[model samples]
Structures are given as C-alpha cells and as structure tokens.
Target: MATFDARQMQSLTGLQATARTFLMVGFTVVETVALGLWLALVQGAPVISRPAAIGLGVLTVGLVVEHVLTDATVNGLSFSFPLARIVGISVSEALLWAVWLGIADRLGGVDGILVAGAVLSVLLVPQHSVEDNILRGEAPLSNVVNLNTIGFSLVEGIGATVWLLLVFEGQQFAGLLATLGFGGVDPAAVGLAALGIFLLVEHDIGVTLARQG
Candidate 1:
C-alpha cells in the first residue's frame, strides 16, 4: 500500500486552491450577467435599470480605489496586469449587486430591499468562506463558520440596506434640489453615491483580512 506524504498533501492543496479560484471567478462572471439579463427582462427595461447602471459605474471606481490602496492581487492568475484584478472583481461585484438591487425593488419596494439585503448577507457567508479557504489552502468546508465570515455578512447587509434606501428614497431630497433650482436628484445618482461608499469600505475590509491571512 502507498500513502501520501506531507509534501504531496501540500501540493494537492495548492492545486485545489488554484482550481477553486478559477472556477469561482468564472462562475461569478457568468451568474452575475445572467442574473442582470433576467432582471432586465422581468422589469421590461432595455437591458438594465438606470440605478443598476449607475451602481456598476460607481462600483468600478470603488474597485479601482481599493486596488490602488491595497495593491492586492488574486493568486493563481496565469497572466497578471495592473488592472486585471480590478477589472475582474469589479465586473463581478457590480453586476451581482446591480441585479440584486433590481430583484429587491421588485420584491416589495422598500420592504423588499431590506429582505433582499438580509438574504444577500446570509449568502455571502459561504461565498466568503470559500474565498478564505482558498487563500489558506484549506479544505473547502474547513472553518466555514468564522468571525470573518460573520463580519463580512454584517457589512454586506448594512451596505445593501443603506444603498437601497438611498436609491428608493432619492425623492426625499427633492426639496433640497428645488432650492438649488434643479428638477430633482435622480435615484441613479443617489444609488451611485451610496454604493460607492459601501464598496470602498467593504473592499478595504476584505483586502485587510486577506493580507492578515
């Protein structure tokens, strides 16, 4: 009989980590875009909602800021560039959040947004767990319920909630806009500002944790 040694186990772990990363990146891109398209069809929009488009643009800027601040790089990339990580992660995150917001809007307006935020927070647990495990080269299910996961869930929930609130209630600022001789604040603009702040904070925390690990 033959058995694996420590070196062999380590090598296997590395291979698993690389495979998981590639799969996750690919799946995220596909799923996010698919979801956006589905939401567009449901909402009768040409492609995506105005708020979603604004959110994506703001998210891109936020990701660029995060990359500049952390100088973080995703591991196991065959080809690396100054903006590769930013572009990949930004597209995934932005599209996911855009479609998520669209769904929340349809669920029940303001109430639905809150519900969706909570749901997304819960879902992020497993997603973050997988990413964390990959970084440490640990087994897929190892230490899934951890402090970092919980913290990220909380952050995501709060961010999503605030973003949706601002977007939905953008009309609340109409009086202020009137004073400025403007028609009103567009919901898209409000969403952009709200999501930009949230993404910046969330990405900073995520990068810090990865660096610590």
Candidate 2:
C-alpha cells in the first residue's frame, strides 16, 4: 500500500509544478471565455446591463487600487507573463460577474440574482478550503476543514450579495446618496461602488485572519 505524504504534495517541483501551473492558467482562460460566449451567443443574453457594466467597471478599478495600496498580487503562476496574468484575471473577474448576473436576470430578476448569489456563496466554501490550504503550504485537505474559514467566506459572500441588492434596490440608500449631492447617479452604479468598498474591506479582513492562523 502506498502511503500518502502531505509534504510531497506541497513540494511539487520542476516539470510537475510547471505543468500544474499551466493547467490552472488554461483552465481559467477557458472558463472565462466559455462563460462569456455562452451567455452572449448561446443564451442571447445581453452579456451585461448598463448598470452592471458600470458596477463591474467600478469593482475592477477598485480591485486594482486595492492591490496597489496593499502591495498584493493575484495568487498564481506569473513568473513569465505577469502582465498577461493580471489582465486575464481582471477580464475573468468581470466576465464572471456578468455571467452570474445574466443568469440571475433570466431566472427572475431580483429574486434570481439573490438565488444565484446564494449558490455562488456556497460554492466558494469548498474552493476556498482547497485554495487557502494550498496557498498556506498545507495539504489541500489538511485541518479536516476549518469552520472559521467557512464562516468568514459565508459572511463575506452573503454580505456582498445583500449589499449589492440594497444598492440597486434600496431607495433609502439612494436617498442618502442624493442628500449627499450625488443623487443624479444611477442607483446600480452607486450600489456597485459601495460593493467595491465592501469587497476591499472583506478581503483585508480575510487576509488578516489567514495570516493570524
């Protein structure tokens, strides 16, 4: 019987590491493009609405600023094509948001979006479980799964979802912005801006916790 060694898994090197890195890159590119095409060409969806487009733009710019301020980079292989990696990641993030929003819009407008948000939130737990462990140099399945990690991710996701809906749908929030002299802006765009701030804060918190652990 062959015993599994966690250290060996973490120490992937040379060809194995390179191959895995390229595989991940290919997967990201394929997934991003496929989702965009499916939403636009196959489903005949608008790809993204004006409000969503504006919101996503804000979110992307916000992320870039956050990265700059925090001196953080997207985690992945970028040894050779750093610029391409950054551009690809930015494009991928935007496309993912558009795809999810497009699907939710078709499902039932606001209700659909909420449903989709919930699903995505749940899906992220396992993903974070694996990614976080790997990034921390532990076996992907180490720790028997951390409840704290799950809790943080869930809160982040739910908070983001609620924040998004409130921005786009909450008249009170818009009214407040209006009172602040920015009433002319589209509510969705405003909501997205707030969403970006929320994400920045959430990311910082997550990073802090990860480091502490």
Top candidate on lDDT is 1
TM-score for each candidate, following the candidate numbering: 0.51, 0.49
> Can you write out model 2's per-residue Cα lDDT over 1-213, one digit (the tens) per residue?
134565556566455546544443443333333333333332333445564555556545543333322222224343332333344344545555555565566685567768867766665565445445544546656753566566655664665465556544566567777887768987655554555444544554555554454
lDDT tens digits, residues 145-201, model 1? 656866866676676676556556657656765676555556545554454455445
- RMSD, one per candidate, in order: 12.0, 12.5
- Candidate 2: C-alpha lDDT: 0.50
Report the number of the highest-TM-score candidate. Answer: 1
Q: How many backbone collisions does model 1 have? A: 0
lDDT of 2 at 40: 33
Instruction: For model 2, state the Cα shift of residue 212 in Å.
Output: 2.9
Which residue pairs does candidate 2 place in steric collision?
Answer: none
User: Which stretches in model 2 have alpha-carbon errors above 4 Å?
Assistant: 1-99, 141-145, 162-182
Clash number for each model: 0, 0
